[model samples]
Target chain A: MTATAVRAPARRAEKPSSSPRRRISKRNFFARLSLALPAAVVVVPLLAIIVVQGIDLVTHAENLTRPGSADKFIGWGNFTRAFSDPDLLGSIRVTLTYVVAGVGLEMIIGVGIALLLNGRIPGKGVIRAVILIPMVLTPVVAGLMWRLLLDPTSGFVNYLLGVVGLGNDHAFLSDPATALPAIIMVEIWQNTPFVVIIVLAGLESLDPSPFEAAELDGARGFGLLKNVTLPMLGPVLAVVLLLRIIDAVKTFALVNTMTQGGPGTSTLTISNYVYRTGFQTFDIGYSTTLGLIVSVALLILIFPTAGRLMGLRIRRSRG
Target chain B: MKRRPAAVAVRSIVVYIFVLWCIAPIIWLVSTSLKSDVDAFSPTPVWFFIPQFENYVNAWVDGGMGQSMLISTAVGCASAILGITAGLPLAYLTTQIWPPESTGSSRATLAILLLTIVPPVLSLTPFYRALFGVGLTGNAFGLTIIHTFYAILLAVLIFRSFLVNFPREIREAALIDGLGEWRALLSTILPNVWGAMAATFVLALIQSWNEFLYALVLTNGDSQTVPVTIAGFLSFFGTNWARLTAAGVIGALPIVIFAIVVRKHMARGLSFGGVK
Candidate 1:
């Protein structure tokens, strides 16, 4: 590296008449062949797996072959089955409640972090990194870690509450009443970083000129934030909200890990419901049809947002 | 100056509180993992104690976390490599095989993006039945195949950014030189876009490493990875804290290391097109 750096300047010094041989190595066909084959070998199979899976999924179309398995045309058989099945329905309800509440909470918390962290603070980079702890951990780990720390008896949350002279330690996750709240608490702890990062990116993109103008126009701190900063951050906020909503809809590992759809189907989300119905019960065909229905239903909402963002993204990659 | 000092302190203090809230749970997890079984379940709770290393060892050795970790590492790393390589060329094809700035690119990109948003669970039935029909389930290759499907979507999204700005004239001229498309892609294209490829690889690593739902669903017990083992630990032990914490910590280590390395790529992957 040192030799190369030293030679770089020397090479530049003589570059007014550098040799053409060095630049013409692009014609090395065998060399290109070696590299191209490896690249192709590496990439092709990975995609083939997914393409294959997709083909398998669409081609099987269980409802078509196996009548009375799920439903006709796969509209809502899986969904209706899920809705009627107490466990699956419970999971769906839990998932809906959590997605709405959890995402709503995340938006507030995330936007707040974005506002708080934007453009100033002590050791902002370190703060940002530390703040990302929850987001970065594997979801299962996050779930299990919380389980250990929040267990009614020996968990540190109990210990902390003891120190602060709070409520009974065992009351947490001990009853059906508090189990879902406990699950939500764990999720909020685990996923809030997603909101922070998304909203932070939005806040980072805003211009300070508006703030300056607002200040000159006698806009104070809260006033500046309300009228100027919030509006500037709108597009990113929308994107963040949209992304988090879909992600929350896919909430499975956390609920599965912490509660196992448990204490009587309280924490079971729709995805977990599908897992239980299909895999656990061995009702593979029915589960497939049901899961498909849920997918199609969610697809209606997820498609437009996912498409718009991807469109914006493709434009970026191009320009 | 007086107001500024107060404002800065207020900002610092408030932000610190949130950060504390963010980290407090993780700090708690680590601390809880160190407590002995007696101390762990004690209703009174013990904050400070002689730290325990036995749990880590117990988790690694007796807990079978080591084996699960190996499986996860094998699957995660392999799938990431495969996913990125596949995604990059597809992105290249999408970019170059069609004219840039045309409706064709839009359609191609949209087609790929559609694949990304398709909920995994929705296709579970078909995929599971298909896999069973072909005897792919419980096999490592089959698991990799399942992982590659989603990871490829991620790869395409990541790889497309690099491929889009790729100079088309360079490709055109390479073609004019009697070089084949694959040859041009390898020699002329990859070297310039190595950084983006690295980013995609890192993103794939984090994603595949953290992936759980598919692994849990697809793999047989023998091939099941860390997350599945850890999540299902409850069903076996009926809520054994000692074993579960050990398993969770063991499961968390690689992902934590990967997260620190690829934190920036995460910014790209998650933001997707938001950040240029």
Candidate 2:
């Protein structure tokens, strides 16, 4: 059923070949142009920026901070400096930690909640609505709210911790040891719902015959879940993981608002590092280099995953 | 299939606990917004207090959030509009006009989608440099143009997925009646995809509204949006919990309402129609 639905459009696209070849070519030319025009409008400026920045980085000509600065050639200097910069390298490590921790927790908790919600439940609509609140709230506001909640002196979170006999003065955001963890906690709290929603959607759309067959074969509870449900959910989980990793790698707003990459740059993700470099320090050349590095990293990470997703879709369409 | 009472009871408990976990911080925010400055800052948790409605007034008036709200709304709407207008035609071209299996259009679509992975921080300086060169810095319209670029990826992805699944028979029928591809798209095809369009628009609007980095770097003073302004309150007010919480609530209010209103389309939109 799923395969056919996926293939229906592909089949239709192949059907018009009997028409006059000239007419088809004309239509295709006009259509392609229309599509390419909008794409160019968006992509051209971005490409120009990247190319210009790339040239500037290599030549060391323009100071992006000051308008109309003269160009001077400085080959590979920014890249070399960026490689040796402890802060940039440290930010990369911090970003890796955040991406791994944030995406991992969100996946586990999100899938767990999704399974729980997949069962017949009362007030499911209300529950789903409530869960989506954090996902919808502005990240800046969410970060601020967490900052308020995690305040050392008057925070509700610390108050609850004290009530439960956990130490309350941890100063989660201010202290270096606990700051990254605190930011990760807030990230998980806000984004776990996204995973829940996506996983739940997948759950709802799943084929039920396998579960029924598993039940008839004496499978129940965790056995059925592990054997029947999870196998079917593999593709959905892959897509969700891809999305979450991309989002997690871009963590900036929360860190900026809550910790300001503070207590000596412990919480500085690569994005925040780049922002500080470009805006605060005004090292436009180095910042652009850092940006390019991040872009390269993202491309390496995403290309394989995107290709896998494309393969999955094509297989579905073909089957 | 008989259900066990114990299992059902445990599930209910888990569900309610999860709901409370999701909502607790928001409840605390609202409570803080309603507390007096002294009560808000009390070392002990303030469970009960007379609701301070005046905090909303103070935040809205004195905090400059009203102007921010107006600016955010205008930016969100303008970007969503431009994004849709540009994105839909491009999606239509990729899905319907170009052959689906062809390398050209699919490659273009993939390239566009890949653009999303490029961290916005990387583009900020160049965007800043370009906008400054054009004298568009700190202008809402300039910010809108930048946002439109950001929004295009979402718009194209959602609309392309939707148009791919759109029935081809309708387009064929419209074509037999002598309509051009553009006309058929506008007249026959677009109406059928209103739900998809709405989903795309809402997603884009919420993104533009919630966006902080660009809004922070690009706009200043009167053109500042709510997120930037609220962040500003932290530096300017320095632990004024009452006004800050109130401002936070006000800043989050519009998107929250919008989210609920379009709750049904959200999962589909967020997943880029993958799950749905």
Candidate 3:
């Protein structure tokens, strides 16, 4: 029921007797526009800065450390360099791996857990409350805590491994092969709860009538879920999947805190690469160019699809 | 088809194990924080030890977490309030004043979504340069503005989801009865949307409090937030496991409690209202 209600409200025709209402609405445009002005004031300037400075910075090969470098305009220099930059290519590959593997596992495991929780479980409330911890734990703390746990020496994971005769001193974060996978594991551990919470809510709010009808028709178990439940859940699942992808693409803190995109840049995501360029390297021109390319590519990739999935009718010409 | 008793038992066990996976690290973190520095880093696990309360005291005082906590709270509250102040009216305009299905409403909402989709990395340098030019960097002022900017984006989306289906005739009636649009929102709509507002405030507050990237870039020294402060402990107290864990616990404790208190509203807010 809520699934449909979330769509645009039905359009109703105006009655002639509501002339006063019409007058108010006509004047209400500017009044209503005024209501949104404050948000515009805060947002527009930042957006303007992004565009104005982005163009200015992208055209110049200005290194912050070099004096009088701001006027050294090199048109398309940064963009051209970025295309051949091996680190940028490698970072993109790493980011894709993170988003795909991390989000994929999260969705599957999260949906499974949510489905399990929806069934008859003991202390359901307490179970739910406990699971929320990982989701809300400060990312930096989560990263550091996981780092401590996964530490090669004096770490509980190694201790457990020793007990199982798997060898105690496994350097998870320091090893290049294991480093990205380890970060992705931490990513799954932290964010899977997000998927569970949202998907569980979606499950709980699902209309009961379809299930009743499916049961009456002798549908049961996986068949029932595969047919009745999942079809009805398509929209919610799409939204959840979209959100997870968007967030996972912006993964920085966990990677930064856990490995600092190290273990030979095995886990260097786009954000980490940008931070490295802009702050660590002090290459302002290249950093802004990278930011613009990634931003534009991301929007081109997801913005229209996100709008449609959210049921917003976006026109090409409008805001 | 009802599940067999054995299947039911297995299912329950699977759920328990999942919960265990989720909670074990947190338990380890807390337990390690209570151990002595040597015990925390013992090559072998220390199953028994006297608890150390001084670690908390040390993390709180010596680590500058206390000061950072104040900075975080002030920034979080200021950003959340500013976000809601700007966001609610914009949500109202898109969902209530304009027909939600109309071109204008869709356009407005799409603009908000576009802003939401644009990664912060794109704007980070520009914002840093702009704010630094005005001497707003290295303090709470610039960071608060950026956080408020994001909070507004969050607030607008969440509020729009809640208010889109709210009946508009009530507001129209109030307008006809001589309540101005602002007055109508305050009297007629605001009362109904306290839940959304609370959800917005809590979520926005959490976002700002937990935010690290911008905080790291924009602020330093006394203005650092919880994440920055706790992260700084890593370099400052490299081998002091107990102190570091204590700092971690201190930093994560409040937000964990707040989230549990408001978990019911979190699904909607976190999903940007997709679930609701």
Question: Which pairs of residues collide in candidate 3?
Answer: none
Task: Give lDDT tens digits, candidate 1, residues B29-103.
Answer: 677678787776677757689988898887777767787788888887888887776676677766654443445
Error of 3 at A317 (Å): 27
Better of 1 and 2 by TM-score: 2
- The residue pairs that clash in candidate 2, if any, are A59-A74, A61-A71, A61-A72
Every model's DockQ, to 2 decimals? 0.32, 0.56, 0.58
Residues B87-198, candidate 3: write the lDDT tens digits: 9988888777776666667788888888888877898888878888899999999999999999999999898888877888998889879887788888988999888888
Model 2, TM vs. native: 0.94
Model 2: residues >4 Å from true position, as ranges?
A1-18, A21-28, A61-70, A314-319
Candidate 1 local lDDT, A178-280, one digit each (tens): 7888888777777778878767776665566777777888888788789888876665666677777777888888878777787877777878877876678
Using DockQ as the measure, name the better of candidate 1 and candidate 3.
3
Q: List candidate 3 stretches off by more than 4 Å.
A: A1-18, A21-27, A312-319, B1-4
Whole-model lDDT values for every prediction: 0.69, 0.83, 0.87
Model 1 clash pairs?
A43-B85, A43-B86, A78-A290, A91-A268, A154-B40
lDDT of 3 by residue, A99-198 (tens): 9999999999999888877777778899889999998888999999999999899999999999999999999999999999999999999999888888
Per-residue lDDT of model 2, residues B1-276, tens digit only: 335878767877887887888899999999999999999998788888999999999999999999999999999998888888888888887766765444545676678767877778677777777777788888787788888987788888888767766666787788778777788789887887788888888999999999988888889999999999999999999999999999999999989988888888888778776677
